[model samples]
Target: MAAGAPRIFVSHLSGVAVFDPAGDQVGRVRDLVVMLRVAQRPPRLLGLVVELATRRRIFLPMTRVTAIQSGQVITTGVLNVRRFEQRPTERLVFGELLDRRVVLTETGEEVTVLDLSVHQLPARREWEIDRVFVRKGRKGSAFRRAKGEALTVEWTAVSGFSLEEQGQGAENLLATFEQLRPADLANVLHHLSPKRRAEVAAALDDDRLADVLEELPEDDQIEILGKLKEERAADVLEAMDPDDAADLLGELPTDEQERLLSLMQPGDAADMRRLMSYEDRTAGGLMTTEPIVLRPDATVADALARVRNPDLSPALAAQVYVCRPPDETPTGKYLGTVHFQRLLREPPPSLVSSIVDSDLQPLDPDADLPAIAGFFATYDMVAAPVVDEAGSLLGAVTVDDVLDHMLPEDWRETEFHLAEEEVATDGS
Candidate 1:
């Protein structure tokens, strides 16, 4: 490439808007396909995975790209609608390379692969990896310490780790997916063939698997669950939120569901049964039984500690249910709820009951979806407590779960596709 030629980082390439020669928007760049070569040689650019408005992904070979500029890629309009498939020799820049471990050729030190710069080769139209931007310490250590500096070195100075070379049964590939968000990991799993999806799922731990499974569509959820051993599947189900586990079990055959439920611990099995008894569109079906709860007399300090748990979803952690004794679900009596904001504003020594929102009415377990939706809209609450007729605290319905049921059946899949387009448009 000419010295003056502008180079683009692979990270920035992702979500760039692709336009036809006539300036009509085609799709957004999701990933770049590349072919690895001998040591010290840059990988060859193969094509672009363009996600269309219809949520269909297609391949756009490099030859079809007329020009590559900041925030946008110009293509020849002539495109192949066939779905992009990875060949034996190809690797995805965003999916496989970013945040991966690569060895520095000179010191043999392993650094986290941060980003890659690609440019057209000198005197030729072919684009190849030009430079690699990497961080020196263990993954995520840089962020925890400070905004550590990055080392920009020639691609040849670092050795790339390829999953294919490590073999099909390699567990190392799981490490790559660990860096991705559950939704993004679900997208990667959705694109893989059933066999590959199972392999990847098997490599993940129960918690991670449960998280990714929750993000997947019902069909994908059923398929992946079907792939696991009965015992392991039960464990993953147990690791999932009670409401989500119930939702998945509801999709399976009665016999299959029974077998899986039987394998789970009795307490978990009972929780699943209780959730399963409710209609799918009701508050009882959508609420998670694991909301943070405390006795009304508990200190604000206790409420803050519970909210500090990293595992709690933002919506679930936004408020704490103040119940009577027997604080576990079917908590003795639903007293009221204390918003997280109140906990922060009041002194730590203050009793939770003093700050509780007793005026906020709790929803009945049998409340319909419309009632649940209106409750959230009217109260402007991220979560609300669910109660039995006797006013015993059962669980809490989060806005996320409510929206999950309110949206269309294929909403997750549709939203994922639309999000990419929105990013593309916003970047443009």
Candidate 2:
């Protein structure tokens, strides 16, 4: 099915043809298998199995199902017959997740996903979908459980879901960490408690979790690191900005730090070691190692071409460093950075120097947190360049990271101020 394909309910499913993206008819729905337990809820379809003329059964797990169209169901990307053989059995969430607190998207607000309530339907008591509720207020004063509220999204409203979708329950209105933008991920992380933070991290894959870790504040990053398993901790730390990795390691006890670094890949560990060489407060310390350094002679065209590659990391900053090529004796050969938005505004054939901002103010590697914050305030820069004593471009520190350090309180104040400003601006 196309992304905007029409959806049909499982109760309405009947003999729908299933096709892979390549238009090969892989299977047809046999019957809607609902798993009603002796006491527990019936399992959502374990999945649909297509019976072929050759008497072979091909199974497509509900998770891989992309969409339900007018007459056809679509599976994502491609189909592998062996996939059915290796299909994961329905997850038995008996231990931890069932009745566990989860982020519930109800009433268009994220409230806690609490346990189900057995509410007798008005007309009959036998038939009932799980009733969801929200716990409101502090205990004693006005603490109350608000019931009969659930996010009843039409199946058609789901644009896409990530791997963690099944874990949150197919029927629950939840989104995967990968599906959220970085800013939204940051906001979600900021709002969650430490334990909840750990649970969310556990739910995400290494790469997506790594991306979220990269954007978080150092303190939250350290706290989140403490809660993760050693293997998971090492994976996220290895993928993070070297400066952040070093800061996180410095916050940990020496023994644990060494253990994590040892588990990391040699190259990542070495880069982290180099970053840790600088004091945490300085320019060298704050700079990210993944700057997109380009040659002075590099044209806007060349940089544009480079940016077109899909493989670029999602954590890339809005600024592209215009520098002497990496082959030069020293990287700080004193060029400048071009804001990515500005670069995109011009034709590819334009010269980089034409768009480069020469008056670029930079920070020394040894600067303290306050100093960096002041730099952010002074220049009103979203990202400030980091440089060595030789004025060579190192990496850059985004304003978000600096704000994370400066504002240690529960970020409510900042959020309030931003909301007020938005209201004022909109009125104007």
- Candidate with top TM-score is 1
What TM-score, computed on C-alpha atoms, does each candidate reach? 0.62, 0.50
lDDT tens digits, residues 338-373, model 2? 877788889887878778887866777788888888
- Model 1 earns a TM-score of 0.62
Clashes of 2: 12
Model 2 spans with C-alpha error above 4 angstroms: 1-200, 214-229, 305-316, 327-332, 341-346, 351-355, 369-371, 409-428
On lDDT, the leading prediction is 1
- Write down the worst ten-residue block by lDDT for model 1: 162-171
Q: List, in order, the clash count of every candidate structure.
A: 1, 12
- How much is the lDDT of residue 283 in candidate 2? 62
- Candidate 1 residue-wise lDDT, 1-428, digit = tens: 23358888888888999999899999999999876654356776767899998888987877568678768999867665645656444578899888888899999988888899898865555678889999887678554752455799998788855333344552445544545889898987887888889888876656678999999999999999999988779878987889999999999999999999888887788999999999988999998988998997899999998887556899999999998989779889888999998889999999999888888889999999999999999989999999998989999999999989988999988977887788789999
Candidate 1 lDDT at 381 equals: 92
